[model samples]
Target: MSSTWMTTRAWLLMLPLLAIMIAVIGWPMADTVRLSFTDAKLVGLGGRFVGFDNYVKMLTSGNFQRALYATTWFAVVSVTAEMVIGVLAALLLNQRFYGRAVLRALLILPWALPTVVNATLWRLIYNPEYGALNAALTQIGLLDSYRSWLGEPGTAMTALILADCWKNFPLVALIALAALQAVPRDITSAALVDGAGPFARFRFVVLPYLAGPLMVALVLRTIEAFKVFDIIWVMTRGGPANSTRTLSILVYQEAFSFQRAGSGASLALVVTLIVTVLAVGYGLLVRRAAGSAA
Candidate 1:
């Protein structure tokens, strides 16, 4: 077949999918953009156009600022912890040992669990009255009394972070483990023969192979972390004085709970913009890492 015919046929094959995407994603996004410019309610005739009023109000609001800070902190800390724990777990699992296969198979459990289920499990564990965590801590004499973990601002975010890490680190580990498999055994053996210590070997030899894949993992995790909603919502509902309120949670509260569709759409777009910037930045980093690896 001629090249033009092949291209035409490919476009024809993709036309249905493209139409579906436009219907499912494109139309809603365009409508959101329209709604964002008005002062619309969730259930009413669309309100009058308000220009950039919603954007200005949201940007200047203290609530938005706090939510942004909380979201940023959650994303940065959770992603960092996940990456570190994942790499360590990957390294440990990569070794030869009995029952390694069983353990490796078990690593999928947390990641495989539904987000709401995982959040609920953690919520029960953090329950002040009869929580596993509090019970264990008190039994070990680490605490005089069971404390409300999710009820305190000081510890709420940390608790959520830990839960998030548990659910997500497995994904990073799987990615890292796959990358580790590609590292040449001969190179590691040579490094060992050269008396390269574990840290030195990992830093100099293993890390180069892991970098590209880990970068991809990092980008995925970071974006997910930034927009986290369901887990936090299920666990805390951005409670303890909104200490755990993320951008997504804020958007939900504005759009649904408060029924301010216009401002909610504006807030959602702002979040989309932030996520887009992060994705672009991470994409650049991924390219750089790939170029370096090449």
Candidate 2:
């Protein structure tokens, strides 16, 4: 077949998908961009164009600043913890054991659960009254009484972080485990014969194999963490003085809860911009890592 004909046939096959994407994603995105520049409300006619007023206001607001800080903190801490715990879990599971298969299957449960379901489960576990966590801590002499895990500013963010990590670490573990499988047994055996310690084996022998996959996991988790919403919403609703308010939550409140569609759209766009920059930055890092590995 001619190259031009092949190209034409491919485009013809993709036409339906392209049209659906334009209708579903492209139109909404364009509408949102238009809405961001207006003074629109959730229940009114199209508001007048405000020409960056919404963006300027949102960008300068104290609430935006606080939300940004909370989001960054959550993303950094949760992703970091997930990566560490996941790699450790992957390493452990990589070893031959009697029930390694069972453990590996069970490791997927947390990641497999729906986010809302996981959040609800964690909420009950952290419940101040008759919650598993409080009961366990009290029995262990760790606490004098039950404490509200999601109710206080001091502990709300930390509690959210812990829940987020639990739900996400399994994904990282799975990725790492898959990468670990690709490492040649002979290479690992040679490293062991060379008298390398466990840490040295991982660092010099196994790590180079794991690096690329782990970077991919890192990028995925970081982006998800940055835009975290449903879990936090179901758990804390950004409550206890908005202590757990992330960028996504802030956007939700601004757009839906407060009925300021224009401002909310602007905030959402800002968030999209931030996420885009992060994705682009991570893409560069991943490329660099791949280049170095090559």
Candidate 3:
């Protein structure tokens, strides 16, 4: 009877959380899924059952294809750059140095800043006239004149990727640093004593410890980058002939701009499904890596 009472108490404690999740997450997700199958309009409630028409339309749309390509490219480039740069920064900072703590704190400022603020700051820096980027390039003889960075189709996505890397690399660095802190110093020392060079030591001794954290960071950064919208909205607004428009922006434009709620809902579900699959794959890989390490 006492055991039964404890079990009941545990369930009672969980009830509120369960209720909140159902109300906030379950209900909306169900509604969105339902809407995705119908001819829903932003202005009306009487949506007829379309039965995958919206999905077919989205699949066939060239604009949707472009958005998917752009989003994929952005996520791939930004995450890869951030991972490489962040790992390097973490390794450098892990070494003994003067003012290390101050430098670490300073590095976090970019990540800690609000996304909109970071986007706006980069927008200013990329401005054609009196912008830091143009001025620097000119000063270094890289450019003959100040030119619009975000106003050109070719350079717009690249500029956004740079801005995103600046704001996000610190997160990866922090995660990597924490992993580095947990590494067995004794093993590293033994590797050094074995005449292992810096690269060999990092490869044989340090890399095993870093794999798990780096994978976690990669998964997180991939998901965030896939759904990136706010910064692009603030900085480029998916302009330069929609060269930088991503899936999130496409969904927004469909729902709000074109008033095609059904199409937007379908696209949103598609995005969610893609992210979920990618995350699950990463999760499985992490589990396998952990098992192998063990």
* TM-scores for every predicted model: 0.97, 0.97, 0.96
Error of 3 at 178 (Å): 1.6
Give the per-residue lDDT of model 1 (tens digit) for 1-294. 899999999999999999999999999999999999999999989699999999999999999999999999999999999999999999999999999999999998999999999999999999999999999999999999999999999999999999999999999999999999999999999999999999999998999999999999999999999999999999999998999999999999999999999999999999999999999999999999999899
**lDDT by candidate, in order shown:** 0.97, 0.96, 0.95
Better of 1 and 3 by lDDT: 1
lDDT of 3: 0.95
Candidate 3, residues 103-157, lDDT tens digits: the string is 9989899999999999999999999988999999999999998999999999999
Off by over 4 Å in 3: 2-9
lDDT-based ranking: 1, 2, 3
Q: Quick one: best lDDT, which candidate? A: 1
List runs of model 2 lying over 4 Å from the truth.
1-6
lDDT of 2 by residue, 1-294 (tens): 999999999999999999999999999999999999999999989999999999889889999999999999999999999999999999999999899999999999999999999999999999999899999999999999889989989999999999999999999999999999999999999999999999999999999999999999999999999999999999999989999999999999999999999999999999999999999999999999898888
